[model samples]
Target: MSLDPINLAAFLGMALVTYLTRIAGLALVGRLDLSPRAQAAFDAIPPAVLIAVIAPSALATGWPERVAALVCGLAAMRLPLLGVVAVGVATVVALRMVA
Candidate 1:
């Protein structure tokens, strides 16, 4: 299949923007001396971002998604991170098949 020039340009532009933002973030953080509270907040970023991305879809979807998210949360309490993810995915797939 042939690549469309416009789509290729758009993809490259997006990649460049993503790369620049990551580099800029690293540079900015490297230059900063954060207070303890600020450092703690920065550390919370990953989980906060994960929830921000997951919460909307989990809440908006039907029972399968909600139940899967709950399973993930419960698994997280007792299982490794990979296991938690596996449980979540399995629950969703099983529920989807049943429905």
Candidate 2:
């Protein structure tokens, strides 16, 4: 199959813009001096975003997901990010099996 020239150019343009934006962010962040609290908040963004994305889907279904999300929310307090994720996955699996 032949590649369409316009599609290829559009893809390349998008890739270049994305790469430049990422590079600009890295440079900007490196130059900034943020407070400890701000740093912590920045670090927390990923997990917060992950939960925001996952929560709607989790809550949309039946009782299993609701219960699993509750367990995961508790686990997030004491556990690290990966551990919290593991707990959530395990809770969902076990609950799905039993229900």
Candidate 3:
């Protein structure tokens, strides 16, 4: 099987963009003199971005997925992180199988 040149180039371009953006962000942040509140906000960016990315799919799907997310959130309150994740995954798989 031969690799297509266009696809190869596009993949490389995406990699380059991702690499540069990450480096640029690190460098910019390193140089900044952020206040305590600003630093806290910056730390929250990752989880906030994660929710932004996942919320759409979690809400758009069927009831099973929504219920799984809710169960996972509740599990997170009492279980270890890995245990919560396991419960969430197990709940979703069980719900999907039943459906």
Candidate 4:
């Protein structure tokens, strides 16, 4: 029994799905007029996705890391968004390396 090939296949499947989704979305969106409700939902998706991804990762860490991530997220809301991500990732990496 082996897991490496299964992991690789799983990763490739996800990558393929992600690529197809993006390509299909781009191909379809411009040609169709989305309903007003759908457009509103689409507008909401970016922030929803950002919060969904960041909230869990930021909250799942230890107290110190969570505090750091919270502060970084607040600071990120003020700076270019990438700064916040950089701060969070760098802090975690540094903590991991030193510990």
Best by TM-score: 2
- Count: clashes, candidate 2: 0
Worst 10 residues of 4 by lDDT: 61-70
lDDT of 2 at 36: 100
Score residue 8 of candidate 3 by CA lDDT: 100
- lDDT string, candidate 4, 2-81, tens digits: 67988999999999999999999999999989899999898778757887877787688666577667777677678665
Best by lDDT: 2
Clashing pairs in 3: none
**Residue ranges of candidate 2 with Cα displaced over 4 Å:** 1-14
What TM-score would every model get versus the actual structure? 0.68, 0.78, 0.70, 0.54
Residues 1-99, candidate 2, lDDT per residue (tens digit)?
A: 999999999999999999999899899999999999999999999898999999999999999999999999999899999999999999999999999
How many steric overlaps are in each model, in order? 0, 0, 0, 0
The whole-model C-alpha lDDT of candidate 4 against the native structure comes to: 0.78
Model 2 residue 14 lDDT score: 100
lDDT of 3 by residue, 48-88 (tens): 67557766887999988899889977986798656866887
Off by over 4 Å in 1: 74-87, 90-99
Query: How many times do residue backbones clash in model 1?
Result: 0
Error of 1 at 19 (Å): 0.5
lDDT tens string, model 1, 5-92? 9999999999999999999999999999999999999987875777689889999999999999998888878986668778888999
Residue-level lDDT for 52 in candidate 4: 85
The C-alpha lDDT values of all candidates are 0.90, 0.95, 0.86, 0.78
